[model samples]
Target: MELLSFGDTGWGDELFKATFMTILVALVAFFFGFLISIFIVPLKLSNKKLLNYLGNTYTTIFRGVPELLVIYLLFFGGSSAVMFVAKIFGYKEFIEINAFLTGSISIGLISGAYTTEVLRGAIESINKGQFEGAKSLGLKKTTYYVFVIAPQVLRLSIPNLSNVWQLTLKDTALISVTGLVEIMRQSYIASGVTRNPLLFYSFAAFLYLILTTISLKYFNQLEKKYNHQP
Candidate 1:
């Protein structure tokens, strides 16, 4: 209780706030990654040689690179990239990409590459017969994908997607270097100021455990909801 005091001297409130930022970053990365992965997976599955090569190249570069290197690259280079685009649009000044944006985009890019592979496998596992049947019923391609393929792919990919979510959550800790002020960063600040690394680090670990447990329960519920349908 003493260690968790809310007074100015204690760091409990700051740590809690930092944890929220960590969750926010993780959620942003996961959602954006999932969204981008849709196109990547389809491209990879296409017969077009160029699209297939493009998808393969994206996955190879992201996955082959070290995560820390990716983070550093984005942290420094993201703002420059944004500024270049801004200039092309006739903007005079630089378009600054904040640390949060840098962190989220970097993680999202990396996670999306992995997610593309997972989603491609799930989409492939679905029988080709179903698509043929949908066509025979006079269903439009878009409608068939939305009503039939999308649901099945999401269901099949949940387990692997859950793993990616966990990885993203852990990876958010690395964004502290970009000055995101997340859980790990806050813990470091507290420990350095208070000289109680063990205590602060233990608190950070417990918070992460709580996050993982809640995420597991939520994913389990989602799995059950999608499992049986009349």
Candidate 2:
């Protein structure tokens, strides 16, 4: 309809941009979270009690907290922490955290918690004989992980990682509270301005459905590719 037209007469451009932003946020957050999980997974798998405890604590806290709460804490508390550190250096200016960073980091922390568990399961699923076999082959630690362990872990974990990606995509909606102009935020703004909440919100839902369906297809392809690997 006219309400969804491009340019000043409608919010088509805004919605389009917002959809892109949503994708960007989800991607950055998911990758960031995966990086975090890479570090935490070793901690959890370590034989040292302190290392294992620390990893468990990180995952438990992040997993137990609500995603919205995590965003609020990162958005508000991050600025305060930065300012505190700045003041300690005799600088008194107020600092505001970037919305994109806050959103990504918050979602990333949550995503990492879930990813850590998924990775742990995948790693544990690997047979003990593989480690012995790699050792007998005189492979270096790095080579063993890269060539042997990594591939199987990735293959086994792809299915669960797909779920994590979907959850991360949905979680991006919570970042709207940070005024990030993502899909939900743009829909809210357009709805408020046009007084057609149903139209814009429905459009937002459609956009999300498209994203999820495409992601599902991609993940399915990835799984098939990995399954075919010898």
Candidate 3:
């Protein structure tokens, strides 16, 4: 109890801040992954073999690799990659990629692969008659997608996206290896300092449980709302 106090006497403040960082990183990574999925989805759906092959390869590689390895590779190699580009442009200074960006990108790449699959499934589940109906109505391509296809895709995707959100949230714990002071990192620090590993780790787990529960409830509400729509 004293160990969880809010002042300098305890690690509560640090843990609270770490929890916030966890949420921030999860949100950013999820959205960034979704952005990546947007481009890849079309490629996977395309009739061209080359484009489909490229998209499938991207998803397969990221999904098959270990998440921690992805983080390690990106964190260690990102700066070198940037510096290589810089030298090509005649700016030869050393570049360093911060832990936050590295962690976010690594997690985002993984998330994107899963999201692409979820979205692809959602799109495929839509009845073919909807497309034919839209075309028969003489709707422009852009208008048809915007007003018809996108909403249903979103509605269909919400449940799976919720799963993605949970996965992304849990994945933030892995970013501790990059030295980001997320929940796991903070817990590790506090445990080492206090020699009370069980307490700190349990607290960290509690915080994560709270986050996941709240997010699950919110997604359920969203699912219900969408399901009720005409």
Candidate 4:
């Protein structure tokens, strides 16, 4: 209890703030990653062979690579890559990306890779007859997807997206390597300073469990709500 107290003598405040950072990182990454999946899924499903191949290559590469390595590359080498692009445009200066942006982009890219497949599979699972019916009703393309397809796609994909969310939440721990003060990083510092590894580590575990519990319950509610659609 003393170790979990919220004051200077305890590591509680730091850990609590770090947990918030972890959640924030995961939330932003999830949103951006899902948006990325929107584009990538269509690219993979595109009639053009080039777009299809590019999408396939993106998913293949990101999914094949380790997430940690992706983080390292983004944090360590991203500036150099940006500088190279600047030179091509007749600019000369060092470029730097902060840890927060680096972590978000790296994790989002990784999540986007897996999400592409999930969204594509969900859309494909919907019956062709549904689309045909929408078309026969003279629904515009936007209206067709918005009213008829998007809801079902989201309904079918929520389970997989939840799994992906869990994976992303845990992956934020890897962001600590880039010097972001997330849950695992805070726990590491607290344990080292207090010489109470067991206590701090356990606290970290409890926090993670809380995060997952809330996420699962929320997704389950969504599942139930979507399931009852007319």
Candidate 5:
């Protein structure tokens, strides 16, 4: 209707832009979260007690805390924390972090903890004898992991990673608190402007459903292909 019609007269354009922001934030968070998992999983599985403890403590803290609180902390406290560190390195100034970057980093940290657990479990589930066999072939450490273990771990991880992706996608809604004009934030603004919460909110929900459904379908196809491969 008029409320959702395109251009300045309606919220349609803003909603579309917000949707794009949602996808971008989710992508940023998921990728960085996976990167974090790569390092954290190794630490979790490391022989050193201190490294293992560090990983455990990280996972325990991030997993134990609410994602919203993490974003709030990062949004409000992150700049100060950054400035504090900068001061230690002979710099004295307020370093501002924009909402998008802050939201992405905060959600990425939360997603990373869950990803670490999933990846660690996947890595541990692999047969230990494979590592010895790879070593016997004289493969370098990176080559051994890439050639021998990464594929198996990835296959084992797809389902859990899919779930994490869902979680991360949904969690992007919470980043509205940081003033990023993603779906939920746009919905709030439109609802407030038009005084028609139901329509805008319902549309917001539908947008989320579309994103999740498409992502789930993609993951399903990926999982199936991985399973069917020789």
Candidate 6:
């Protein structure tokens, strides 16, 4: 009865809610970052030097910096930057970004950095002869990539990119420092208020482990399915 109590007494509701929010944040971040990676990967693979340089710079700066620093910089500067742009468009009234948006973008940016590398590696792994054949067959670059590179790249990178997703999911806990109601934040509060650090933190650990295990199983199944395909 005590363990199942709502809100303050048992931490049952708070833990569940925070866990859900954490998963939500990770999902949103992964989606946006994955989209960004698609563009970055191809541009980096382009023959043009400028595009390569730009993509390299993006990956370098994001990946080289600590994630906590990245989160802090984005959380503090991102809102101001948004409002600055809004002001130029003449619609500024102190635009605010809630912690969720801040966490999502910050994590997304970091995830994009790693995802770009994974995508680039996958793209490079494809046979260069295939690309030449596509060109020789009069397929446009867009068509070649759409019909040729994208499918193979997705298949090749699923294992590596699944690792990236796991990294991103765990890193979401860092966003607790920004005051998001993630599992870590909730556990911190519960430990302090209830003066039961062991109990609350243990619960948090188990919840995170459960989430990761479930995600790993799905990724493995996906990998198996793709692997068995022609």
lDDT of each: 0.89, 0.94, 0.94, 0.91, 0.94, 0.91
Worst 10 residues of 5 by lDDT: 221-230
Writing each residue's lDDT as its tens digit, candidate 3 over 89-144 gives 99987888898999899999999999999999998999999999999999997799
RMSD from true fold, candidate 4: 1.7
Encode model 4's per-residue lDDT on 1-230: one tens digit a residue: 88888998777798889989999999999888999998899899889999999999999999999999999889989988888999999889777878889999999999999999999999999999999999999999889988999888989999899999999998998998988889989998889988999998888899999999999999989888778656
**Per-model TM-score on C-alpha atoms:** 0.94, 0.96, 0.97, 0.93, 0.95, 0.94
Largest TM-score belongs to which candidate?
Answer: 3
Q: How high a TM-score does candidate 2 get?
A: 0.96
Question: Positional deviation of 39 in candidate 6, in angstroms?
Answer: 1.6
Query: What total of clashing residue pairs does each candidate reach?
Result: 0, 0, 0, 0, 0, 0
Preferred candidate (lDDT higher): 1 or 5: 5
Cα lDDT tens digits, model 6, 61-122, are 98999999999998899889999999889995988899999999999999999999998998
Over 132-208, each residue of candidate 1 has an lDDT whose tens digit, in order, gives 99999999988999898998999988888888898899889999998889999998988898888999889999999
Candidate 1: lDDT over CA atoms?
Answer: 0.89
Q: After superposition, which runs of candidate 3 have C-alpha atoms over 4 Å from their true positions?
A: none
What is candidate 1's CA lDDT for residue 136?
Answer: 96
